[model samples]
Target: MTKPRVLLADDHRMVAEGLKSLLAEEFELAGIVEDGLALVKAARELNPDAIVADISMPNLTGIDALVQLKRDNPQVRVVFLTMHRNPAYARRALQIGALGFVLKHSAPAELVLAVRAALEGRTFIAPDLAAEVFRTPAKKEAGPAEALTSRQREILQLLAQGHSAKQIGAALNLSARTVEDHKYRLMETLGIENNAELIHFAIKHGLAP
Candidate 1:
């Protein structure tokens, strides 16, 4: 049988290039994209058998792109390439019609396995991440980040976009002080401080590209 055709999407140039070469050894690398909107457009244009995209991408986000792709091309398979080990994200990816959610920390072999499995109508999650996820300490039940409300997550995303506290407040319809409060809380909860750290965190977890 012929190998599968795969489209790889990630904002990190080095990562996208590296994965493309690695996966190319085993499959037909249909294409690669650097942004979420480009990913959507590439998928529509290329019509690859499967698409593997990072969760956080510029413009539309990986999840949002996946949603649109599924709507427009229901027969296409989607596999999320994420750094987030959070079970919540895994569940959300599934809810959005992704065929699989594979954490980036998994062995390169695992990624290959996930790609082929997804092609064959099977779902795969990184084994180690899956284990740790289920073992989330009950005592640590509410992860500090989890304590923040949905509004806070929204603010954090904007902050990573280089928005000033006042700008974030204006966009979210809150006072600058409120934005500051949320920023302080997010730093405390996510164990990150300053805008730089927040951006690093978001990109690390595939929440930003």
Candidate 2:
């Protein structure tokens, strides 16, 4: 029998290496990407049966990347592997169509189980987070920060990470002027006036760590 195709996305080189080993036996490795933007591109090209991604990633977050991917391939399964224990993140992942939300600290077996559940069209949350995922009610309205477009949020994260417009542009394949424009618009939307304030806003709103 053919193994399921899996795409892996995470910024940490060591973590990606570890997952590659663990997943090798159970799934056909489609490709591995270091950031969310690359993950989206790779997923589109590879058309994997499922994706395992980290929530906090550069260029675009896993959730945002998955959002874009779902627009074109809604049947693709995604299981988020995140370091965040925050129930809010888990709830958001599920709400955005992720079938699994496993914590980074979870046992390796749990990730395998999560992947299997996702492939079978079932939902899986880390045992510790399962209760919280269910206990949380659906959000009726988008949060102020959530109102930002995916591109805006990506630029905001780079800004919060202290990347200059030129660096951010190079990273995302946008022009420096475009990066600057996005920064300005994000700042205006959030009512922030400067880089310091923008960084603070991103942290407070969980746009960046």
Candidate 3:
């Protein structure tokens, strides 16, 4: 039988290498990308059956990238493998259509299972997080972070990573002035007054790299 195609995305080379080894036996390794932007590009080009990604990648976060990917391909299967143990992150990921949320520390034993489940159209949350992730109602009012547009969230992630307006503009194909305008607008929307608070908010809400 042809193995299921899998794409791996993680900023940490060592972690990606290890995941590559773990998944290679059961699935075909379609590609490896180091950041969320590259993951989005590779997923488009490769059309892998499933993607194993890290949530806190640079340029764009995995959740944000998935949001964009799902816009074009809603059936895209993704399993997030990350160190973040916060149930809120897992909740947000699943709410956004991720099929699996596995913690990095438990990956050796759980990742393949999660990937398989996702490919089979099943949802899997790490055992440690499953209880808390599902304890709350499925629907909730949008939080402050959820209120930001996708472009604004992208710019916020870049800003939190210490990129300047010019660099961000270059990356997003906007002018520096436009990038600055976006910065100010997002700040006002979030009710934050300064860069330090913005960075703190980003980190707190899982928007930071």
Candidate 4:
């Protein structure tokens, strides 16, 4: 029988390698990428059966990448593996269509199982978080970060990561002036007065890795 094909995405070399090893016996490793942007690209090119990804990755976050990927291919199956133990994060991830949310600390024992579950069209939340994630109200008011457009969120993350307007423009294919305009507009939308506060908001809201 053929093993299910899986793509791995994590910025940490050691962690990615360990996951690769962990999943190798039961799944075919379609590809591995170190950033969310690459994860999006690889998933498009490779069309793996499932993706194991980190939520906090460079260039684009796993959630943001998923939003974009889903627009193009809604059937894509993603299982997030991350250090974030927050129930809110898991709730948002599942709400956004992730099939699994496994924490990094529990990955050795749960990741393969999560992948298997996702491949079988089942949802899997880390046992430690499942109750809390499900108990949380699904219709809570949107947070400041949640109100931002996906592009704005991307720009916010890049800004918090210390990328200048020019660099961000280069990465996002916008003009530097446009990037600056976006910064100001997003700051205003979030009621932030300066770059420092913007960064603080981004970090506080899990928009920045």
Candidate 5:
């Protein structure tokens, strides 16, 4: 049997390394990309059978990248590997067509199962979070950060991670003024007064780890 081709997207080098080692025996690594923007480019270029990505990534979030990838290649399966245990995140990933959602702290064995399940057209969630992830919330309330557009959410996460507007602009290929304008708009939309408040809001809403 032919091994599936896999692409990996994660900003943390260590995490990527660990995943590469874990999957080495089971899959063919098409390529590795460090950020979501690069992930998009790599997906387009490599045409992998599956992708494992982090949710919080520089330039673009993994979810946003997956949206683009799906647009271009709807058949490719994707499994999200994230540190966040938040059910809301899992809900969003599934809504956006992710095949699996695996928590970073879960046993490495779970990842293999997730990959196999995804390839078989089955959905997989970390065992510990399966109940919460599948349960319907009492109310479909959008979190403050969730209300923002994908770009805004990406910028917000970067800001919360202590990147300045200029740095964020460079990373996202936007102007510094544009990045600042986004910050201003996010503040107004979220009823935040400053960067500190914005960071607080991001953490509260799972936009930042």
Candidate 6:
């Protein structure tokens, strides 16, 4: 019988190594990836049966990565491995079509079981997160800092911290006009009437310093 194949994605090298050690015995490790995009690329190329991902990875978050990878291959299952014990994120992950979420603090044995369950077409949320999601609601869908794409969130955060448009442009390798356009669009999306409101909103949302 062929073992299940999986791709590992996480930013922490030691964590990845530890997981690889635990999984290699029961699974055929396909390839290891360090970022969400690489995980997506590997998933499309390797077409592995499963993916175990860390949620806070760079370039793309694990949830965003799952969204993209499932777009590419709906049949492949994903299990999020995170240190977060937040019921909200766990439920959101399920709502977003993830098959399972394994808490990093979960026993190593549970990780193995989570993988097996996912491979067998079963959903496996962590035992501790078995509560109704109390996810924050009523936040504006488009915040003042949301004009930037996933890649631009960090940049916008800096801008909110009082960086000049030229400084932001230089730092991001974008033209000043481009940064201004982003600012304009961000304000429009958030329905802010002026730069003062924009800055206020950004600061309130912790996007600004």
Winning candidate number (TM-score): 4
**Model 1 lDDT tens row, 50-99:** 98889877655787678778888877788888887778787668777887
| lDDT per residue as tens, model 3, 1-209 | 99999999999999899898999899999989998888988999999999999999999999999998899799999999998898988988998999999998884769999999999999989998899888866776888998999999999999999999999998888999999999999989999999999999999888986
* Best-matching candidate per lDDT: 3
lDDT of 2 by residue, 141-176 (tens): 877787898789888888888888999899888999
TM-score of decoy 6:
0.72
Pairs clashing in candidate 6?
Answer: none
lDDT of 4 by residue, 21-123 (tens): 9998999999889987788889999999999999999888999999988987888899999999988889889888999999988848788889999999999
Model 6 regions more than 4 Å off: 132-184, 191-209
TM-score of each: 0.65, 0.90, 0.93, 0.94, 0.84, 0.72
- The RMSD of every model to the true structure, in order and in angstroms, is 6.7, 2.1, 1.8, 1.5, 2.4, 5.5
lDDT measured at residue 66 in model 4 versus the true structure, 0 to 100: 94
Where model 3 places Cα greater than 4 Å from the true spot, the runs are 137-142
Question: Model 3 clash tally?
Answer: 0
> With candidate 2 superimposed using the best TM-score fit, by how many Å does residue 157's alpha carbon deviate from the native?
1.3
Candidate 2: residue 161 lDDT (0-100): 82
lDDT agreement of model 3 with the native: 0.92
Q: Give per-residue lDDT, candidate 3, residue 106.
A: 87
lDDT of 6 at 1: 88
Residue 185 CA displacement from its true place in model 1, Å: 25
Clashes of each: 0, 0, 0, 0, 0, 0
- Which residue pairs come into collision in candidate 3? none
A best-first ranking of the candidates according to their lDDT comes to: 3, 4, 2, 5, 1, 6
The whole-model C-alpha lDDT of candidate 1 against the native structure comes to: 0.78
Work out candidate 5's RMSD over C-alphas.
Answer: 2.4
What C-alpha lDDT do the candidate models reach, one value each? 0.78, 0.89, 0.92, 0.90, 0.88, 0.77
Model 2 / residue 164 / CA error / Å: 3.3
